[model samples]
Target: MSPLFPALRTADEKEALRFGEHALSYAELAGAAGALAGRLAGAGRVAVWATPTLETAVGVVAALLAGVPAVPLNPKTGERELAHILADSAPSAVLAAPGDLLPPALAALTRIDVVATAGAADLSAAEPDAAEPDDTESPALIVYTSGTTGPPKGAVLPRRAISGTLDALAEVWAWTPDDVLVHALPLFHVHGLILGVLGPLRRGGSVRHLGRFSVEGVARELTAGATMLFGVPTMYHRIAEALDTDRELAKALAGARLLVSGSAALPVHDHRRIAAATGRTVIERYGMTETLMNTSVRVDGEPRPGTVGVPLPDVELRLADESDGIGEIQVRGPNLFSGYLNRPDATAAAFTEDGWFRTGDMASLDADGYVRIVGRKATDLIKSGGYKIGAGEIENALLDHPGVREAAVTGEPDADLGERIVAWVVPADPQSPPTPEELAGHVAAQLSPHKRPRTVRFLEALPRNDMGKIMKRALGNGNG
Candidate 1:
């Protein structure tokens, strides 16, 4: 629970981060974070532009260490979204990459200090008390959701939440000092910040960060050497698509000791393809904004295709209704968030009477302890003519079809059926796009007639937010 960055630095001086053409040692990075934290303490709520870079990483830790409540924002945020977050966080100070990238509103803001990506000066000698958090229960970060379903809400994560997640991940993934984590996910996301930045630092390991990810770019990083590679399903699928045939991505994933996937469902097809391409089973896990991560594919045994493996240490998962094998996934663990910031009403509604965080996700668990996610609490299944249907089931079946590249299924309002399945998809070959009739025929062979999509809409590409999550709500309600 102590400063994780300092812990990593103490463990290995040579621990360095890869940024562009330079390599940054742990000692230097820690010093910069400490000094910058000292400079940015005036902002009661500080918003730091988040991206996967050595500078962004240090800036976040610096703000927190400075006792400024930190809010991580997307770099590409437009005027409206940027204003909302900036106003909500109300940062009196700003620490940003130099140039016009800093908000114009920032000029009027008092006590603002902008630190260039050109690492801050060393502060080992002048290190402020920096108000090292005395208790793990204190808030360590504030991250805003993309608000695809509704307005974005800020989730406040305490030290316990992050530390507990790192501890749980270290055990589940068997991360150690010997490992080098390769980070490619965006920093604004919890998956990138928690798993990419904090998770590695807690285990006293180093990180190799890329500003962006391309099939070829990641391919090169996979070759650069690392003990573990963590990414969302989209990244893994891209890597799988570009790798060798026989050994698949085995040679590409040559240096990695393990691969972990979360942030979104890791489709069965993509999971198998990654294993076939790289000879490494891409371990798909279950987690969300409220909880950093709870379940993951184990290091040793079967990394099943769809299941998110078992719960991590100190975390317990159970169905709200135990009799049914599948129900709301309720969890009790240190890794869970403190609550939504400034929303006591929401906080009260987030947990059950008994205190488990009600993960909106619906899931089913096997006797051997493997768990497969079914749907979201707000929107995972559809009801039609009093018959319930799992959207993932239909989407997965559609994805298996050779012509389908990506698929998302949602239940749409129907006058007769109450709600019916509607599928939006992207074909593998745009020129040879499959007809709705063809897709319906393809899924009917696999899915129950009741579960077959009532409507299929072909999209050049499914509408997804910056994080690559397929926006089913947008597709179904005619919002996009």
Candidate 2:
């Protein structure tokens, strides 16, 4: 089989990764990861303390080099979630940085400390010739899903899925080794660990990770030669808010080659704000843990503010039959996970009879094949009195109001309307919150009258996960 990262052998000693004060070159990374891979060659599976650090990157790379399935555990995960993952994956050993404080959940597991070996003159000289695992179908990583309804299921991703997704993105983004990617996303999720980190490595490019996300940090990296910036909606929202007052931030962002957003939908208001300030449209993409990536806006294509452009090369996408042209996105592609680990029944239900993985995300495809994701099927799809309304459209409408700073919409049981739309809003000013009637009229004016909020609840902030995705279930349960 061809190597996943050929640059590890061919590329010159250019910088490969930068996290905070630490940096590693291709040669140095190979030496460090190769040395660690030799020790992990026969491990059943390894768990990585996925902190946004160079050690975490090196640890995952080492596991990949040895063809061992690596389960990346979120450093900030609660004790319960962390314990669940540990029991579920049953990793033989845990990989962590030196002198790191491990939680009690990982106390019983065998620990392997990942250390910096960049200064070692012959770090790769005496590396053992470990036999590579020949099967591409073998699990490379077992990523856990967010347990919204139940315990997080482990998605068993194969080596080919990662390779296929990265290659397809390379084509769409015009990605090259000369590019430098920058982001401050967490390291456990697919968006951060796989794309933000590994995507650059696959192309022989470098990555500069902001240990913590800040508008100042973004400007610093971009000013220092970073070409691409990756962030979620919250991060972009901050950027949009700061561009007006920070001249250096605006100038630095305007010079960037590409700006990308994912994990959650970027509001059209923020999109327009960033474009007006930076002259760069933020590209959006859609994917999940089960599917590494299905669609993305091409570098060569027009940047539509609200659309997550065409299906990637070799990915087959089709909406389930719907009269309104919006339905659950079902996809068939090489960039798909093998199955949910140890959950045959659940895995069997995730796919259709014809073998397409049901994405559970509601989206519409334009005539030109642009995919505009409406929302999730279970939470964001509202069946009103007689019409099926997507909560995203109404939320977007709510976001357009100057008084609204953040918004999340969900449907609740109502006898009169069958299901009434409820808007959870974080007002722009606490002293003068937008009245329910005024916000309702605002949404009614923007969209149809039926899409207006029947009930409006004001909050200081929306409850969000680590990735900045609103936890709608919390709102549904009256916790927000």
Candidate 3:
């Protein structure tokens, strides 16, 4: 089997990674990561304090080189959640940048300084572990899911899954060694660490990370010849908002080869705004923690605003239990995680006997096979007035209204309707906010009358996780 990152071996002394002003060429990265990998070899498992820094990237790459499963710990995680993860993964030691203040929870474990290990090897002679994993089934990253349903479960991703997903995406997006990707996403999740960082390395391409997301930073990077941009909906939403005033930002975005959004559905409103200003359509893709990537809007395909395009190569996707063209998305592919860590029962429950992994997301397939995700079956699927409604569509409609700045839709038990649609909105003008009647009328006019919000509650902002995904469970929990 080929190495996951061929660039680490064969690429020239060109810069491979940059976070803010700091950078490492291909040779420097190899030296740093190789030195750390040699030290990390035979370590059972290691936890990386996954901060948005060059050290975090080096730590993860080193762990992979050592044939060790690296668990990425979100730095923003609370003490209780952090304790649960440390206990669950049971890493022998932690890898973090020098001088980073780790919480008391991590103090019990031995700490390996990542930056201190750099330049410890001969730069020209440094090479990563040549031996590939035992046929790619070997564990690479143990990523924990956002604990929306319950406690976060670690999804054990294998070498094959990482390489498979990146290869499939490369085919669809026309990703190449010439492409320079830029993003400001956190390094903890799949969108950031796996795709935003590792994707470029696999293609032997360069990546520039904005340590913090800013319109100026995006403009600066893209203007300096970055070909691709990856961001979640919230980040793209900021870009859309800034494009009206920042001509340089719009010009930079227009010059990019590809702009992609994921982690959540980007509103149709923001999509139109960006396309109008920059003439560049931001494509959306669908995937989960268990499934690295299932579908994507192809570079050559029609740039649909709302749909997440078609399934990628080698991924067999099906919408199980179809009713009104909406069903649970189940998939089977090489790009799937082996299972949740140490929870055989939970893992068994996640898949069918025939081998399809049950993705709890509810979506509908168009005639052209484009997947339009509505919402989660647990929270976003509202069965009301003898009709099953998707909260995503209603939320999008509410967003179309001039008065609604940010919107989240949920279903509440009602006496008349089986479950009534409730819109938690951050209005554009809070002092003279759109009333429940006006917002309901706006949605009713856009969509069907039944899809309108039965109750409209105004908020200053929506409750969101580190990834910018709205926490539907936390809605009406006194946080909003």
Candidate 4:
């Protein structure tokens, strides 16, 4: 079997990773990770304090090198959520950067601080036998899902899933060693760690992490030869907002080879704004923790504003029986996860009787196979008065209004309507918000009268997760 990252052995001196002021070449990374892999050789599973740091990257790499399944814990996780993950994964050791202030949740686990060594030569020489697992089916990562429905379940991703997804993306994006990726997304999720960090490494490319996202930071990297930018809608929204007055930022974005958005749908309004300013169209992709990647707008294909493009090579995607062409997205591919760790029933339930994983996302496919995700099946699909409505379309319509800065659409129980659409809106001006009737008229004009919100609730902001996804459950609980 071939190595997941062939560059580690062949291109020893090429720059591999950069986080703020820290950097490591391919050889140096191998040496550093190899040293840690030696110590982790027999470990069952390890937990990584997944900060946007070089050590977190090294720790995960080392665990993969040693054939040990790694669990990445979000640094910002609350005490209860943190404890749940810790107990669920039950890692043998906890990997952290030296001097990292760990929460009480990780106090009991054996701690291993990942430190940078001298060079690749010293560490490589220390363990020539430290090699990646030959079996592609072996578990590589145990990433936990956001427990919106229940306690977070661990999604065990195999080595093949990572390699297959990256290779497919490499082909889709025309990714190469010359391409330098830039982003500041959190490392605990698939978007940042798997694609942002490992994708570059697998392609023999380099990644420049901003540590934290800023308009200035993005401009500096892009102007300094970074070729690609990866971000969620919030980050891109900021970029779109800044491109008007910030000439440097606009120029930097215009110069970028590829601008990609994922984790959540990027509003079409923001998409057009960025394109109008920079002459660059942002690409969107769709995937989840269980499925590394399923669809993406191809670099060589049309850069559609609102649609996530065709399925990757070897992925089979279909809409689960709907006359309107909007249904739950079911996918079957090599990139699919093995199962939810330690939850056999939940794992079994995740897939259909025939084996396709139910993505739990409501979506529609165009004539050309582009995927437009509507919303989550559990929350965003509202059956109101004999019609099925997707909250995402309504939210997009609400966002188009100049008076609305932020918007999330949900459905609440109504005695007459079964479920009535409710719009949670963050007004652009607190002193003068668009009236409920005005916003309803706007949505009705754009889409249909049925899609218009029955009630508009004014809020300072919509509740969001780390990935910038609107938390509708929080809104129902009066937390938003």
Instruction: Summarize candidate 3's per-residue lDDT along 164-249 as a digit string, tens digits.
Output: 99999999999999999999999999999999999998998999999999889999999999999999999999999999899999
Clashes of 1: 5
Q: Which segments of candidate 3 are over 4 A away from where they belong?
A: 116-121, 124-127, 130-132, 477-480
How high is the CA lDDT of each candidate model? 0.74, 0.90, 0.91, 0.90
Error of 2 at 354 (Å): 0.7
Candidate 4 achieves a global lDDT of 0.90
Regions of model 2 farther than 4 Å from truth: 125-129, 478-480
* 78-190: candidate 1 lDDT, tens digit per residue: 77877777776667765565443566655655533434333455545325476766688877888887776656778888888888888877777788867887757888888
lDDT (Cα, tens digit) per residue for candidate 4, span 130-204: 656899999999998999888899999999999999999999999999999999999999999999999998888
**Which is superior by lDDT, 1 or 2?**
2
**141-209 per-residue lDDT for model 2 (tens digits):** 999999887999999999989999999999999999999999999999999999999999999999999
Decide which is better by TM-score, 1 or 2.
Answer: 2
TM-scores vs. true structure, each candidate = 0.92, 0.98, 0.97, 0.97
After the best TM-score superposition of candidate 3, give how far the Cα of residue 312 lies from its true spot, in angstroms: 0.6
